[model samples]
Target: MKKRRVLSLVSAAVMLTGIVAGCKSKEDDKIIIGGLAPLTGNVAQYGQAVDNAVKMAIEEINEKGGILGKKIDYRSVDEKGDPTEAVNAYYSLVEEGIVALIGDVTSKPSKSVAQKAAEDNMPMITPSGSEESITKVGKNVFRTCFIDPYQGKLMADYAFKKLNAKSAAILFDTGDPYSTGIADAFDAAAKELGMTVTNKEGYASGSTDFKTQLTKIQGSKPDVLLLPVYYNDVALIAVQAKQIGITAKLLGGDGWAGVQNQLDEKNMDVLANSYFCNQYDPTSSDPDMQNFLKKYKERYKTDPIMFAVLGYDTAYILTAAIERAGSTDPDKIIEELKKTDYDGLTGKTVFNENRNPVRLAYITTFEGKKEKVLESYSVD
Candidate 1:
């Protein structure tokens, strides 16, 4: 009887192992997509928006009978806006057998993960990373926003022609590729527009003191200050610029993704009359855009910033590629993504040979936490 009991126990143990293996296989069977975001830092608002917006898209798609008749699984992780951390998040998601990736919202980390995705032959689409070099990593990589040259030139032209600015000063981060690239393009455009660049200076990333540079720009007394920096830095710079009595109009790129969240009521006045380049007009009246905004607000109980629009579009775009490819294979998805010209909430997004989307850059201005759309520009 004792021997019989021992044998039964051994049989039960074997059955348990089989059950665990079966569950693993079931999870592995589902098609997985990965997302990377900086969900815990100063710019966490952008990442959080991307994360939530994509998850909402995934849910909507699933409810309508997920892609290819299989329920889609998402493995999204936060990298805290660090490049190395972003790579680590990528590998973790890769282990879950993801067929494609979306994320690394900022340029530096997105560029890092894009290189890794290239090596792995993974299809990637960055919702917000605007660095020009990102798409050049590989054909497997794509983006939903225009690059710096177009954005910079557009800003310069707007200042010179729209705002009637005769001179500009640029202060950017030398260590940041995005900052430098936009600054270079702006400088060239300023020259072409016959606007003098009275001052151009570079400060390393994470530098707290911009008063020195602001003083120099104040001395130059330009009509506009091209502050091609991130939102956190911009908040500080904006305050300092006002303190130093530099009243030049401020401008920036998409790195100022969630500046409104960073500013207090007192600080909002400082950013008044400033403009920034953005991927989408959050208050657009286009029917499609209006629908998206309505649905997004219904889900989140608030209007979304630009990153949320991008995140939703990126997911929407990827799902389109998945349907077009009719498979979860990365190679097939990349092929389909390249041929895509989807009517997105942001704009009609068409990927170029470099897999970068040729889309409109909305010149957005702030009126004390209220975003006003100035105009939109398209690159040829």
Candidate 2:
């Protein structure tokens, strides 16, 4: 009877040990991240680029070894370019046990996600949302791209000094926070520099008919026209302005970064002297940038845009924070991120108190088939 009792106790101990081992295995296998992007909607191209870049970064990290010896898994949900949907997406990812978030490309969606993430104390980094308000939310929110004020000031200075344009007209999209922020900054800077902003015109987002607005701008006959709008709108406005015989020198913010691709040869010629600010330049002498281009091309079969580079850098920043924290604790990661001063593809990045990148904005112009870097100016 004594022997039988001892045998039963040993068997029970073995079963308990197996159960604990199973639970440990399950815990060790779970290290998932969340990506929020607009995979379907107006800004889908940019969102998809960001998503692809993040996925590439994850795959490269996993190939070496994942963080804390656990494989990193990511889930991307389509926000559909809606702010409310973006909020829902954030909650869903949090419910799914995602410790970090990368997402919501535009300013509106990023704003929505950032607000909720800040409230929950979740660590998040935006890839391409350049509105100034994003980082101002809290320490939990970060961005790889510089804000509109930086780009606006850079462009305003460039127009006055380099382009020799004293008087300019402002054409902006009021519906976009990004555009409005840039427009406001540009107007203030132009006024400070003694440059005359002859007229300021606002257009509704998604409006292709800008002839009337362009006609008004043309009437002003300013030396330059500063367009703080996106590529699609810029292209439409450029074509209409040309039709109405407005030959003023065109200038733009980073929203016009890829405008050439959206225009034909004839349309591009119409905006021949146009220049815009950009975050990354492939022609840069930075060895890190060169290596990034090589690796990105090898993986994606195409060169990366400023957005893609920003997305990749955003992932690296998050990974570095996680590695520095040595755990997935949200507060610990946020603390580590505040101390980050790493060199990214664009340049050396140091996050301010608001978690926005402190870096220079590069000025580039559409020179026929490519963009030419004119200059780079740092933010004061």
Candidate 3:
């Protein structure tokens, strides 16, 4: 009877040990990251591109060996390009115990998410949000791209110095902080550069008809027309400007990156002199950029846009911070990010006090068969 009791106790101990080991294995295998982007709305294409790049990065990181020996698990929520939806997505991700977050792609949604994440002290990085105010919210929010003010100044300076435009008119979207910020900065810079501003006009978001605005602008007869708005509005405005026979040279901020794709080929002819600011030129011969281009093409089976590169770099920076911090503490990660002077695919990324990237901006124009890089500028 004594021998049987001892054997029974030993068997129970072994079973308990196995159970604990299984639980430990499960815990060791899980690492959750959060993503928020507009997966089904007007900006869905860009959002989807960022999401794809992030997923690819996570896959590659896992293949080699994930951060701290655990595979990365990501949960992505579609913000649908709405501010409230973006806030809710952040809240949900935070509640789910995510270690980090990427996105809220556009400016407005990103701003909303950044504010909430700051309040919650979460480590969040935006792939393409460009409003100047985004990084000003707090130390917790970091952006992979330059702000709209730099982009606006880039175009304004280029217009005055390179294009030799003496006077210009501004057409901006009132509902978008991104557009408004760029327009404000461009107007200021143009005046400082001795360019006369003939007229300034504003339109609501999602407005298709700009004939009235264009009519007023045409009457001003400025040397250039600046449209610091997104692709949808840009397309409509370009088409309407052509319809109204306004022949002034058109210029735009970084928001114009994919506008040509949305415009009809015939309408694009009207914008032959159009130019915009961007962060990266895929045609760059920089060795880092070349390798990124090759790897991105190999993975996605296509060329990457500025946003894709931004998304990829954002992931790499955040992962590097994690590695440097040696833990998932938000405060520690923010400190590491502040110290980031790492060479990324875009360029050398360093953060200002506001957590915005101090980087170079490229001025690009559409030529017959390609987008030509006109110039590049770095912010001090």
Score every model by TM-score: 0.85, 0.87, 0.84
TM-score-wise, the better of 1 and 2 is 2
Ranking by lDDT: 1, 2, 3
What's model 1's TM-score? 0.85
Q: Which 10-residue window in model 3 sums to the lowest lDDT? A: 19-28
**Evaluation by lDDT, superior candidate among 1 and 2:** 1
| Candidate 1 stretches greater than 4 Å from native | 1-23, 26-29, 41-43, 287-291, 294-303
Lowest lDDT 10-residue stretch of candidate 1: 14-23
Root-mean-square deviation of candidate 3: 10.9
Runs with alpha carbons beyond 4 Å of true place in candidate 2: 1-26, 285-303
Q: Encode model 1's per-residue lDDT on 1-380: one tens digit a residue.
A: 99958955764564456445534654745678889999997679789989989998898899998888887887688778888778877876776677899888988899999999999999999998888989898889999877877778888988987889999999999987878988999999999889999999999998989999999999989999998877888999998999999999998887786787788898788888699978888778898788878888898887787889889999989998998899888889999999898888888888888888888788888876878878886545
The numbered model that scores best in TM-score is 2
Q: How many clashes would you count in candidate 1?
A: 0
Query: What overall lDDT goes with each candidate model?
Result: 0.86, 0.82, 0.82
Q: What is residue 33's positional error in candidate 2, in angstroms? A: 2.0
lDDT of 1 at 111: 95
Best by lDDT: 1
lDDT of 3 at 251: 91
